[model samples]
Target chain A: MSGTESPAVAVRRGRPRDAARDRALLAATLAVLAESGYGGLTTAAVAARAGVSTATLYRRWSSKEALVLAASAAFAADLEQRPDTGTLEGDLRILLRDKAAGLTGESGRLMRALIGEAAHNVALAEALTAALIDPVRDRVAEAVRRAVARGEIAPLPDVDLVADLVIGPMVSRFLLTAHPSDTQDTQDARGTADRLLPFVLRAVGGQDASGDGGFA
Target chain B: MSGTESPAVAVRRGRPRDAARDRALLAATLAVLAESGYGGLTTAAVAARAGVSTATLYRRWSSKEALVLAASAAFAADLEQRPDTGTLEGDLRILLRDKAAGLTGESGRLMRALIGEAAHNVALAEALTAALIDPVRDRVAEAVRRAVARGEIAPLPDVDLVADLVIGPMVSRFLLTAHPSDTQDTQDARGTADRLLPFVLRAVGGQDASGDGGFA
Candidate 1:
């Protein structure tokens, strides 16, 4: 769901002015969301932040939910890039490292805000799956496909399960566990990736090319 | 922390009438939290729901955060009972299955509300680690210890990492992914546990005693 194909943009075709305005609005939405959270956010506040009229905001998105969903989708699209590091372990390290880094900053705040809102909002929950979880799932599948093609491991029966096994620990550590902000450093991410690599490789039935000989 | 050790209850020790009131207040807090989420909950509302005055609520819990944390801790203590099925896989299956079931009900709602609030509140986050995550980690460690004692597996280097590997996927599925409520059935929990057991065994350097081999 890119800008060009979005219904809001399609309805206002040939208007580069509105496209720029849309970006400002989305950015403003994210900013407001990060600061005030989903419950505290309002269309009027978003409009005020974007220097637009409430009428203009309403014309673009029907409700607060729609605006938040659109903003989240736009934001997630920007973070959807995945690396191809040849080996599965290499690919996972870069991807998870980036994820760890992301979870320590604004992206993390945005996620927590959205997740909090999504708990009571079914439509928002679906939007989150489409915007965030779906993209991650696609990236994991691609990584697994490359590994299989390169003969790193045999074809897996369930790539989704493999994805969960690979990505779950990082998510758990960042989201479910409590840690001081100072401790969430790049070195921590690298060490976590290093420790998890052998277990991941073993789970996927691939040999640990790192020669770490599994956890001691 | 249990009710007896809680400062709120400790101050009012030897008052049996207040102990029952405290339970009612904590239960009311959870009920309100489930319905209104962390953002929508108020000390006044919780007091009203428990048929108590704002003064009484303040006397017991100084603020909304304190009230929510107490309620959450008490609620979590009820769900902390772990199973012992002899084998590591067996114990995990039962535990994860119970977790899956819990995620579909009021416990899930409570957790989501807490997590949503935790993203913004460091105190809440730490409280959650103490109230929820720590207990689960303890249970996982106990299970691993039992397995080691039984010769089902060698000692692990990091039981916390092992715990993450085992529990993270299920949490990711229920919390992060969007699914229709009707589909969150017991069979699904069983199937998920079945699929994850092999990977968990492999990750912890234990043999898959269930004879399922690995993921097909």
Candidate 2:
């Protein structure tokens, strides 16, 4: 999948598909996801909302899961990008703060719904593990490797385990709290990141390299 | 809320409810939850499965959310009970292993569904926080207190933060991996606990107290 090619391009051959129409359908999916959640979302409703026939929607995406995956991927892709901030601590803080910010908007709504649906839908669950979770894990792993290479932190036993250590608390808090996308919850999540940062650094033996700041 | 009283008891006066019947209903609810998940669950379906009328189910529990919460709480209660293992490490290892064990079978299915449904249902979210999340957190906090008192670890920072650090990775891993409940995954999760334990001890300056062992 090239950056320019939409997910729909693979299914359709030479037929000229309207990019605007695809955007409309995906936007409708997001709206339906936010308004009614994944269980309540239907392709017919999305077609109606997007001012298109069900055929048009299906021609691009085969199932509701596919459409939702495509839409969620658009948002998660932005978060999957690796950050370069000279230091691992700086990069992590920025990544976490940006993540908290992302969880307070339309993208966050889609994510919350996707996560909910993934619990019951095996296909969606697998897709989520591959598309969203793996990417973030890979990005974090890359960051850790860079940190180790720069002598910012000592290498440890398992990179994946350490990556999980860094992101685990924030993800757990977010899932349990079920906070809506709002400024207050976003700030609260950021506060949680601040507290966890020190421990995460200490877990990896990055105390001196992290510039020696209190967890407060 | 008393040990002698069922949750259904206080809601209705001297109606002569059968505790056996309540157990059957909750069991049916779990069956439905495992088969249909929370979104597909209905009071009517639960009533049918329990061989009772909708009115009978409603008489004891006002809503589907309430019934599910009560059912989930029944299982979560078992997990909330404090384990006295003579040492913090022993307590933590047992707790983590037991928790991993619990995240399997019928209870795990219900938990996955409730967590999914709770994303959209505020009442379920709050009830989960109060019933399941809070109790486990409190138990951990109590464990930390005991450890500190026994001089196993010196406490300076927040207990809740430390608690989160301990449980967060496990929760996050479970959510992300969506691994099936088998001996392999259970063993893997326990291995994760073993790795995280020392870091947790180290985080609280318990490296010397934790009886040093290599993370490898």
Please tell me what DockQ candidate 2 reaches: 0.46
Q: Give the range where candidate 1 chain A is weakest over 10 consecutive residues by summed lDDT.
A: A1-10
**The 10-residue segment with the lowest total lDDT in model 1 chain B:** B1-10
The whole-model lDDT of each prediction reads 0.77, 0.71
Candidate 2: count the clashes.
Answer: 0
Chain A TM-score per model, please list them: 0.85, 0.82
Q: In candidate 2, which residue pairs get closer than 3 Å at backbone N, Cα or C atoms, i.e. clash? A: none
Off by over 4 Å in 2: A1-17, A44-54, A178-184, A208-216, B1-17, B42-55, B151-154, B178-185, B208-216
Error of 1 at A13 (Å): 7.9
Fraction of the reference Cα-Cα interface contacts (below 8 Å) that each candidate reproduces:
0.49, 0.42
Top lDDT prediction, candidate number: 1
Q: Write the per-residue lDDT of candidate 1 for residues A1-216, one digit (tens) a residue.
A: 243466655567647877888999999999999888898899999999999998778778999999999999999889878889888888776666666665655666677778767766789989998987777778888988898899887776666877777667777787776763334665676577677777777777666664654745
Off by over 4 Å in 1: A1-14, A44-56, A155-158, A179-183, B1-14, B42-58, B82-84, B146-151, B179-183
Residue A202 local lDDT, model 1: 74
Model 2 CA lDDT for position A188? 73
TM-score of candidate 2 chain B vs. the reference:
0.82
